[model samples]
Target: MTIAHILHRVADYDAWRKVYDSVGDMQKDGGVTQESVHRMVDDPDNLLVIHHFDTMESARAFFGRSDLRDAMERGGVQGEPRVELFE
Candidate 1:
């Protein structure tokens, strides 16, 4: 299994969350098996998302999707998200 740790900031957490919640099918379609969401204590807009996938290839493919980028932009993601992978 592979785990992806993604950290990014949003212009508004509430607004971004509404968009995030609307993309529930994206995760499943990307082969994500598990997920978790967290917010920074010092900066509420800073968010962390952990996603588990069956393989690194699947995770990488998901991360590289243009639709995901568009969704993030539409969701009010402030800047590029930092992503790390774990096995």
Candidate 2:
């Protein structure tokens, strides 16, 4: 199994969550098998999102998408996001 981990800050968690929820189809299309989200205890705006994929190629492909950035921006993401992969 492979996983994509993303860390970022959002301006508003509620708004961001709505945008995140709206991308269910995109996530399905991206080969994501499962996902989870976490927030920093002390800094609620900080987020860590995890996505599980069957292969590293799929994980990379999903994260490499240009439109993912646009979605994040629309969700009120506040800065550059950090992405990592694990297998």
Candidate 3:
């Protein structure tokens, strides 16, 4: 399995959560097997996101999608997210 670890700040956590919840089908189709969301202890708007994928390629493809970018914008993501991968 491949795991994607992501960190980013959002303008509003509630807005980001709404967008996150709305992308269930998209995530599944993009080969995401599972995901988790968390907020930073010191900064409420900061997010710690983890996604499990079948392969590293799938994770890369998913993150490269324009729809994902659009969703991030809609979710009020403030700046570029930091993404790392592991197996």
Candidate 4:
């Protein structure tokens, strides 16, 4: 099964841009073999990250990495960003 991550941000574009720029390299690195990312039209601040991993284990392994989590936090992301995991 594929794992999907839905992220919603309530911050301004400048904050989002800053965080996005800081994490640019990390995001380029593939977490899973098969992944697709999308931005929702309903909410410009919302981003949908879809991953089609070889297995749920692989997906979890990637998502559970502390390095990436640290990077995200260090990126200085502000506002209340909601995250939802779906399978």
lDDT (C-alpha, whole model) for all candidates: 0.92, 0.92, 0.95, 0.55
Full candidate order by lDDT, most accurate first: 3, 1, 2, 4
Best by lDDT: 3
Q: For residues 1-87, what per-residue lDDT tens digits would candidate 4 score against the true structure?
A: 656564645345446556655654554463455555466787755565555555566566666667756655654434444544456
Model 3 residue 17 lDDT score: 95
- Per-residue lDDT of model 2, residues 17-65, tens digit only: 9999999889989999999999999999999999999999988899888
Which lDDT tens digits does candidate 3 get at residues 1-87?
999999999999998999999999999999999999999999999999999999999999999999999999999999899999999
Off by over 4 Å in 1: none
69 Cα displacement, candidate 3 (Å):
0.2
Report the Cα lDDT for residue 20, model 1: 85
How many angstroms is residue 61 displaced in model 4 relative to the true structure, after the best TM-score fit? 1.5
**Position 80, candidate 3: lDDT:** 95
Evaluated at residue 30, the lDDT of candidate 3 is 96
Question: TM-scores, in order shown?
Answer: 0.96, 0.95, 0.97, 0.55
Those runs of model 2 whose alpha carbons end farther than 4 Å from true positions after fitting are: none
- For residue 74, give model 1's deviation from the true position in Å: 0.8
For candidate 1, the lDDT comes to 0.92
